[model samples]
Target: MEAVFLIIALALVLMVFAPVAPSDRARTPLRLRLARQLHLWDRYVYHDPQIWYPRD
Candidate 1:
């Protein structure tokens, strides 16, 4: 029972400090590709198209 408790504590500690694995395509500091940047720009602009394209 003590060994099981210790194992669980070790696992919890490891999970707390585990280095993030490199499986995410959206990792930090990722440079935006041209198309992705354009799409992002579109989403941004489209999010409030009226702000940029006012219908005054």
Candidate 2:
């Protein structure tokens, strides 16, 4: 039981501290990706306006 708890704690720490890539093509850590998807980190995450609203 203790070992399982330790493993879970370690995984949580790793996920929280994992690095995120700035570019869309680059891979982002799961935690950060989820935050972005939920709009929790929108200020910190970059969104290219061109991608969302392209001028005709």
Question: Per-prediction RMSD in angstroms?
Answer: 18.0, 14.4
lDDT computed for candidate 2: 0.60
Using alpha carbons, what is the TM-score of model 1?
0.34
What are the per-residue Cα lDDT tens digits for candidate 1 across 1-56?
79976875575555444544467644443233334445655686579878678897
Clashes of each: 0, 0
For residues 1-56, write the lDDT of model 2, one tens digit per residue: 79976875576566566665566666866766656544633542347676467799
Question: Candidate 2: deviation at residue 34, Å?
Answer: 11
Candidate 1 regions with alpha-carbon error over 4 angstroms: 21-56
Residue pairs that clash (backbone atoms under 3 angstroms), model 1 = none
lDDT (Cα atoms) of all candidates against the true structure: 0.57, 0.60
Candidate with best TM-score: 2
**Cα RMSD, model 2:** 14.4
- Write out the backbone clash pairs for model 2: none
Task: Name the lDDT value of residue 23 in candidate 2.
Answer: 60
| TM-score versus the correct structure, for each prediction | 0.34, 0.37
